[model samples]
Target: MADSTQVFAILAVTLAAFVWGRFRYDLVALAALLASVLLGLVPADAAFLGFGHPAVITVVAVLVLSRGFERSGLVDLIAEQALRVGDRLILQTLVLSGTVLVLSGVMNNVGALALMLPVAIRLAREHDSPPSLLLMPLAFGSLLGGLTTLIGTPPNIIISAYRQDLVGEGFGMFAFFPVGACVALAGLLLIVLAGRYLVPQRAGQASLDAMFDTAHYLVELRVPEGARAVGWSLRDLHQAIEEPVPVLAVVRGEARHPGHTFHGHLRVDDILLVEAGPEEMALLEDKAGLEVGPEPPAEDGDGGGDEAGTVDTEGLQLVEAVVRNDSMMLHRTVGQLRLHNQFGLHLVAVARDGGRLNQRLRDIRFRPGDVLLLQGGEGEIGESLATLGCLPLASRNLSLGQPRMLLVSVAIFAVAVIAMVLDWLPAAVALTGAALASLLAGVLTLREAYQAIDGPVIVLLGAMIPVGQALETSGGAALIADALLALGRDWPVVATLAGLFAIGMLLSNVVNNAAAALLMAPIAASLAEGFGVSPDPFLMAVAVSASSAFLTPIGHQSNTLVMGPGGYRFGDYWKLGLPLSLAVMAVAIPLILIVWPL
Candidate 1:
């Protein structure tokens, strides 16, 4: 009893931390594990064992494989096909959501969503529709797709591992197909038919100019003959400015130099591409003898007038990219990253949560999902983005296909699936083997493979698993199970199942889905024990509901990834998510009963 009380206290604090959103989830999970160890609820020797758990290994391998799929050019090929479909909203939604759904079932859902994001944004631009109309549905589709396969999502994998510890056999690779497929199909229909309408229409940062409204801030300053600034170095000029105005580039006649790296002294006719508001623009002219020059004409297809700073010169490019969750830039300011010195990229402007950041460019710390407008050498921009762990917002330009590599990657993935289906090897071993094969086949570089693994999520899974075991071993799970069982004693067994499902769904909305499963699985098993029924139905309920985190942006990384790019506020999610979640619950319960009967 005492141990259960302590474990309960630890979990309560952990859940509170997760909801507080001040610290990372992995940090919260690690704290929970350490607290349990200090209280003697979990032995110190066994606390780190979860790091080596099969579920963690499988998740790591899956992430590497997702990157392999990306490098093989198969995903890009398929994206090209998706773009060819007519611009009708329903048809576009169906194709985009359906492709992500199928891809999510095979790869990490977050990764799958990342691959499809550019395609969805392209569709929105082509149709002249708000990206808000498409991104939410695409994010929701990623969640629904994960329901159909054991390896489709972290929750399913965690739940399967829990079952293996109990019964000595985890669910088969396709075991989730019967119920999961039906639920996914129903959810996709909702998104295609009516859910798209629920998405609020907002002007997102869908285009280069749309993101920063750069014309308002980006101005040109020319150095006239005999001007006081003519002999000033770029560094000296920077010291003269009062406000944090970044000089993005310097055009001397036809030659363009990146301001971040320019060491040459200023000269007459030097056209400075400066990011500054009116006051700073005035300050530069008064203090440095810099006069505002005529705005540079917009590039073709830029719709000209007032679209300053939206041009690509002969050798220079302005690209928009979003920082990935695992980006090195997280919590690091532009100065710390040395974007100009190391990568030769200039920080032009930044947008987050539907608004432009008001801070100076160098002081603005990068966060995951921040859309950045960068200026860099045309030849180096693509390589720099990959190195920085950012995804370009624009569609990639690639040759149509690389048949040989694509075939090899697909063949390796197929063999792994076959091995899992035949029980020739455990899911972890098969996936690990497939990842190795891809590495040897040159599908992805070693650095790319390592970058693909989401470090925070791995830490969360590794740390939470041991804590979840402590919950069961200390009987905390049984204590909670008894209280719930007693309340539902008069209800039918299905009602208990429904209650468990609802609890899982609500909890997932506030925590990581994997953590939600880790915390809920033990209680679910205990409840099955109290009812003297097989744990299959109960575990299935927990798995499905945990992945149904559709009510909030913070509920899932997929939702959060699209929040800035889609221009969605916190409340925007529930508009479509609430109805889709209810639809999923309605379809999942009966199917769970029929498929995994008590």
Candidate 2:
């Protein structure tokens, strides 16, 4: 056992580090763990064992299974069907949010949010509604749904595992679902009825078609005497140019061939009538030695208008795209990737989740899932993005064929979840099997499955597990629990539960939810023991509170995911979230008492 002073010191430092925001919670946990080891509080051999714990494996497996659901397009199909049911804003929110909430109860909340986000974006586009109003509700719904099931959120799983260790039995698969369902239903009703009034209305009213304007321009590329373009028709050039831009016309020997009739083969002296603007022309000229044709008149504007009311379509075009996690272009700095030199497009502004980029252009290391506002020639932008393994924001012309293999993917996932839940197989083995099955079934490729996992989150979790164990073994949790008990000796059990819930919620705002839950669960358990009550209620409180992170962008992945797309401000979350959180507390406290009696 650690000395009281040592335990207090550790708790203080951990809390301070968590609130600082300068260091990641995982690193802080690791640091605390190392301190405990050096202080002789935890055994060295057992220090790193948390990485292999069941909770960790369960979380990872859930993430993988979630990815399979996404790749199979099952979620998208559901979203499409739901949207076709109505056009009323309130009705749409009710249906979409309710569906996501129900799905999240059975799957990972993060996965549920990821699956529903595109659908929400599509709905916002269709209704001309700002995503801001809809996204927060969806994020809240996802969080609420997680409260309903053991596997809904990582924090819930961790708390359940901790309970099993302490009392020799943990919550059953649907043990908390009744309470969670009521809470989710109440919250969903509040959002659908009055959420729009609370959440700010900031999404501009712009048609999706009008928002993404492409600048068209004309330029000429010279074909070497022996190059592939020497004898190819203008239609042949279409395949060579990258996406976002297509050749509209061909100019050869002073005669401009409209794209529709330009089918003749090219000769050695033929100046291939290429259609590209300054940016596209510059890239091709530099890369393939293409020549720029005479500049077109400034007023024939390809549609880009300046602040001075002059449209200069020939000059440049601005486009916006959200960076997908699967994008190969992530993590590379613009200068290192030579975005302009290689792709012929300039990186003007980078919007991360929803935060602004005030940093120097060279200093920004592009993260996966960042939204970018790019500027360049319209014709070449799409092609450049394709080369970078990115999908355009605009709908693709490709058709979704009948997915005959979706049933196989679904069966594999269902079996994996059953095996893990039933304790017949390790969670990791089940998920790995599911991922492999997805690849074999052609639902997603091996490369796609690998890309589905978020590396940073996995690394952060692995590195922090040892640290969380150190805090537990070092008696840090005991010290904090004792302090809370001292302050509320005469308070009711419900009050104590509420205090624990509030503390967990506050901590989650600053630190990762998993780390917050791991740190707080033991403390809540200690408090329960001090009061001579069952720890189950307290543990449930911690689970629900840790996952209800609606106050800040950094608190939850779902919140961060919608930031850039919704164009929300930092303060916007609290406007809707504060009341919602309070309501959750009011409803959840009573539910916890009734569901898990003290």
Candidate 3:
């Protein structure tokens, strides 16, 4: 009884920390694992064993394989085909969402969504459709597709591993298809048929220029002959302005110099591209004796140039890109990154939370989903974005894997799937082999493969697995199961299943889905034991419910990712998500019973 009480208290604090959103989830999970060990609930020797567990290995391999799929250019091929279907919104939704759905089953769901995001935005721009109508369905489809395959989600993998420890054999690659495919199909139908009318339309960041609206913030200042600011260094000009406006670049005689690197004195007729508002522009003109002028016009084949050829903004182009969750820019200020000195890129502007940021560029720290407007050489910008772990918002053909490597990557993936289905090798071994094969075949480099692994998620799984076992071994799971059973004693056993499923679903919304499964799986096994029924149905219930985190943007990364691009609010999700979640539950319960037999 004391053990159960202690375990409950530890879990309560862990869940609270997860919901607080102050610290990283991996750090929170690690803290819980240490607490369990210090309290003597989990042995010190066993505390680190989860790192080498087969589930953790499989997840890492799957992430690498997902990266291979993304770089193969196969998804690009399919997206190009889907684009030819014309402008009918329903057909576009079906094809776009359906493509992501199928891809998610084979790759990581988040990776699947990442590949389709730009394509969906392109579709919205081409058709003049509100991105709100398409992005949510695509995001939701990725989640539903994860239900169909074991590797589709971390929760399903966790549950399958737990079943292995209990029954001496883990679930096969296709074992989840029976119940998961049915539930996923039902959810997909709901998203396609009703998602259009249900999801609210908003002014999303549908286009590159539309999102930043840089025209409002940018001003061109011309240095006239004998002007007070003439012959002054760019630093002196900025220091004299007395405002926060930044000089982005200086154009002189067809040569555009980045403001940060130009140490020479400003020359007459030089046009300074400054990021400023009305007040700052006024201050610059009044204090610096500079006059505002029209922006440099673009010449054919020259991205941006002046008509008189005095100010030629050549070689510098603005590229809008979003910071990914694993971005090197995250939590780092522009000054820290040394955008100009290190990467030869200038931070012109940033947008977040569906609006442009008003903070000074140097003071603003990057965050996931924050859209950044960067200025650099067009030739090096794509390479810089890849290095920074950012995704460009502009629609362009993917250049990584071309005509020949596509076939190589596809062949490698197909072989791995065949090996898994035939039980020629265990999932972890086969997937690991595939990942190594990808590295050997030049599908991805070793560095690229390493970057593909989500370190935080791996940490969360490795740390939480031992803590979850402590809960079961300490009798905490059985005690909770007993209380739930006593409450539902008068009701049918199916009602108990429903209650367990609901609890897992709600828990997943508040925490990571993988963590939700780790915590709920033990109780599910306990419930099945108490009822004298097979645990297969109960475990299936946990897997499906844990992945149904559709009610809030914070419930899953997919939902949060689409929030800024789709222009959705905190309240907008439940409009479509609530009904879709209910449909999943309604479809999943009956299917679990029939497929696994309670």
- Residue 206 deviation, candidate 3, in Å? 6.0
Worst ten in a row by lDDT for model 2: 306-315
Instruction: Please state every model's RMSD to the true fold in angstroms.
Output: 2.7, 7.4, 3.7
Prediction 3 TM-score vs. true: 0.90
* TM-score versus the correct structure, for each prediction: 0.93, 0.76, 0.90
- After the best TM-score superposition of candidate 1, give how far the Cα of residue 502 lies from its true spot, in angstroms: 0.9
- Please give the TM-score that candidate 2 achieves against the real structure: 0.76
In model 3, the clashing pairs are none
lDDT (Cα, tens digit) per residue for candidate 2, span 58-153: 676676667667666667677777767556888878987898998797677767876677677777777777777787888888988988877788
Clashes of each: 0, 7, 0
Clashing pairs in 2: 242-383, 243-382, 243-383, 244-382, 251-273, 353-564, 354-564
> Of the pair 1 and 2, which is ahead by lDDT?
1
Instruction: Give stretches of model 2 more than 4 Å off.
Output: 1-25, 205-304, 307-333, 336-348, 352-360, 363-370, 374-403, 416-445
Candidate 3 residue runs with Cα over 4 Å from true position: 204-208, 223-248, 258-265, 279-291, 294-316, 325-332, 336-344, 362-367, 377-389
- Backbone clash total, candidate 3: 0
Clashing pairs in 1: none
Best by lDDT: 1
- Model 1: what TM-score? 0.93
Under the 3 Å rule for N, CA and C atoms, how many clashes does model 1 have?
Answer: 0
